[model samples]
Target chain A: MEKRVLMKGNEAIAEAAIRAGCRYYFGYPITPQTEIMHYMAKRMVEVGGTVIQAESELAAINMVYGAAAAGARAMTSSSSPGISLKQEGFSYIAGAELPAVVANIVRAGPGLGGILPSQGDYFQATKGGGHGDYRNIVLAPASVQELYEMTIEAFNLADRYRMLALILGDGALGQMMEPVVFRDKEPIDLPKKPWAVTGTGGVRPHNTITSIYIKADVLEAFNRKLQAKYAEVSRREVRAECLNCEDADILMVAFGTCSRIGRGIIPIAAAQGVRVGLIRPITLWPFPSDVIARAAAQPSVKAVLTIELSCGQMVEDVRLAVDGMKPIAFLGRSGGNLPTQKEILQKIMKMVGR
Target chain B: MQAVFKRTAGLLNIPTHYCPGCTHGILHRLIAEAMCELDILHRTIGVSSVGCTYNNYEYFACDMVQAAHGRAPAVATGIKRVHPSKSVFTYQGDGDLAAIGTAEIIHAAARGEKISVFFANNAIYGMTSGQMAPTTLIGQVTTTSPFGRDPDAQGHPINVSEMMATLPGAVYVERVSLHDYRHIIQAKKAVRKAFRVQEAGLGFSLVEVLSTCPTNWGMDPPKSMDWVAEVMIQQYPLGLFRDPKLEESK
Candidate 1:
């Protein structure tokens, strides 16, 4: 039997990343996300990996860019403000078509709002946080176990698509402790990175890893290729967990820690005789929109409500996904505050007109 | 009845977009020669700067990556750390290195990153039609400093080589010029030596080449060479500023 141990969410991300064959971790220290760096700093050397406590978030992201270009499994983690600093490098990484994993342990922020749990970066992560035309495979984990599992999966997705992969979590999930199991999973066989900038060793034509194409036609072609990749990812990789969504009058949509709150709201609403179900998005970018629309399309479902840690960021996507088929509502707690299960249950009851 | 000379295989056989007398071509040739002689052409990755040479990836025969304006050093740092066995070098201009990328280069050097830097200091932003650069001389006139640079207003010119030499992580630092044949040869030697330092796993190494922008400087080819010798050299002197091995011996 595998040993189950209690660990912080951030530690699970680090250990899982190492087991996932990530040998390079470059990050700057920030609130709610520093544990990832601390764990890596302690054990990376023993695991024959390298941990770079970079000067700033900018340096950290660029280091990941270099390591990724050289065909190493590289990653960086930061909270809201630090992730913002990394945007320039992110744009470069996307343009260069390098595979990298970035984790944003979210804190409330327009600008350094507070070091607490908030899903304020929904649009930034799902949309383009960096400048330019690009998309990242955004994963949102609701539990510590999922955090560990998603981190390992993130590396695989990144290499599979040759694109940026993002894991979005908030301070609450990052700080929370839960029982986690470390599994000895078999290694995944990713395709050879023939385009990596490793020494050619005089074996083939020198390979250049760049995002620059001065010609308008060449750039347009490259953009078309990227769009094709995004389409394939969206078609094949949309992930969501639907619970009790079958016979419901009200469907609740949430993700990350908010989903855990929704899980609590379900049992309470059931006891009170309200048929409220959930469609929790695990992949936030290729955002399980079809699942959401189908759940909302249920004959018994009358309304959809999105509860987030921010003021209606993910609600926009829900609105778009639902297409005004049903009345949609939003409830949020911003600036590091969290909503309670009672509040969500009350909202569900009101939506049911009871 | 012999082949007098041949272009180094490290450079692609294509005409450059550089102006008739701009020393960027000279610097490119020197770097290519260095790569060829070192026999690291296959294993080398060049990080191109976003200046006049933004598309230099097309000119170099090795693996190349074009970095954002002023981010080549950071990008090169990334590439080198992952594949330490491969040779990594960043080719940057004055505006790219001295202005926007100051923090990146300084930090990469401070960390003792094992990479070579080829800094082309033309004292002006050549690509964007001649704005004053960080290395612009005090009395130099450009689009930004039309009435010549006033120190009180614009601040003093930066001697990047001297500043870089102060960092303990910087193992080899040299400032060379591409004015005449003699200095051009020396500049080539400096480029080779900088790469050698990285090949030997010495810490950060850089060769600051004082180049010319004839089109931007409003000077003809020959006059630009003279200006590089007579004017640019006086402000940014040509010499080796740091050598770890030499320092240890002393």
Candidate 2:
């Protein structure tokens, strides 16, 4: 019988990645996310895997790019500024169509804002943080246990799509500790990469892994192919949770730490004679748009309030999903300020004419 | 009748996009020959940096990965760490290495990564049409330095080989030239030795080849060769800066 082991959220991610067969980890130290690197540094050695405290985030991501190009499961972790530094490499990895995983334990930022949790990077993660026509599978896990499961699933998704996968959690989730049961399970599906850059050994034609297409037409065709892949992902890979969404007049849309607070609000609002439902997005990219659309389509749902740790980012996606079907409101704080349950409950009270 | 000359199997039988009179073709040939001679062609994975040879992946008869500008060293380090038994190398130019990628190259050597680097120093940015490079000599004129490079204004050129040799992890550092037949032969030897150092797991190795860019240098192909010998060689000297075997002897 397997037993539950108490682990930090960051440690769960590190340990889970190792179990998922990630042999290469390159990271540079950054706030809140530093523990991920520390854990990997200690454990990777025991597993005979390669882990390096790179000189900078740029090098770390490029290292992931190289290892992925060579057909090895590779990942890197960093916070806000560090993730910004890695954007160039991320673009290259995406353009080259290499499979890689990156964890952004997001901290407050427009620039060096604070080491506290903030969901300010929602736009950056869901949209293009790097300069290019590309997207990463952004997995937003709410708890330590979810962190472990999603990290393992992230590797498989990255390989299946030949795209980058991002574990987009904020500082609060990164630091929180809880009991995590590391499951003994096999991969969902690990596909063979025939186009990896491992040496041909004179048996096959040499494989060239690159993103450069000097001709305009060739590049357009490649972009079309990538768009088709993303379209398939949108149709098949969306994940979200809808709780008490039926027979409800008010719906709260949130994710990550905000979603945890949202769950608490459901009970508090219940005592106040208010009916509220919540939809928490698990996949930020290829976003759970259809689920959101379905929840908003419920005639009993009168208003949708999008709460977050940012001024507003994912609210835009929420608006698009709702599509003027109901009145939408955004309530939140930005720059390391997290919304409390009391604040959100009060906002809901005003919205429901309490 | 036996053929007097033939191309190395290490390079593909295809045309290259390099400008006429550019020595990139020569440097590519020397490195390809070394890969063939060392019998490591099958297991060699090359990192192509952003420059003239960014697409050289198409020319080398081995696996290749193109890296972001100045990030090739870091990329190559990742590849080498994963497949310790496989041969890995990066081909980078002056702007890619000495300027933008200075940090990566320095740290890769400092960490004693067992990978080979083929550095091309043409004293100008060839891909972007002749900008002033980090290895551009004082008083040397290019598109960016139309009046001539001034030490007080643009700073002095970097002697990358000498700087790299200072790092203990850089076990083999050599600066060679492809200005003439004799020096081309010597440069070939240096390229081979760089790979041999990585194969021996000695540490990092680099071969800085002083090459010419005729179109960007505003000279004929023959004059470009002469300029490398007379002008470029003065700033970036050709010599072995570090040798693992020599250190062992000492």
* lDDT tens per residue, model 1, B1-250: 8988988888889889988988888899999988888788988999888899998888898888778888787778878877888889999998999999898899899999999999999999999999999889998999999999999999999999999999999999999988889999999878888888898898999999998898988999899989988988899998989975632211
Residue pairs of candidate 2 with colliding backbone atoms:
none
- The residue-by-residue lDDT of candidate 2 on B145-200, one tens digit each, is 99999988999999999999999999999999999999999999899888888888
TM-score of chain A of 1: 0.98
User: Which residue ranges in model 1 land beyond 4 Å of their true spot?
Assistant: A188-190, B246-250
lDDT to native, each model: 0.90, 0.92
On residues A242-307, what C-alpha lDDT tens digit does candidate 1 reach at each position?
Answer: 999997888999999999888888778888888889999999989998999988998899999999
> Which DockQ-derived CAPRI band holds candidate 1?
medium
| Residues forming the 10-long window of minimal summed lDDT in candidate 2 chain A | A184-193
The pairs that clash in candidate 1 are: A66-B78, A66-B79
Model 2, A1-354: lDDT tens per residue?
A: 669898888999999899999989999998998899899989998999999989899999999998998889999999989998999988898899999999999999898899999999998888988998998899999999999999998998999899999999999999999999888486534578889877888899999899999999999999999999999988889999999999888999999999999999898898888889999999999889889889889988889999999988999999999999999999989878888888898899999998
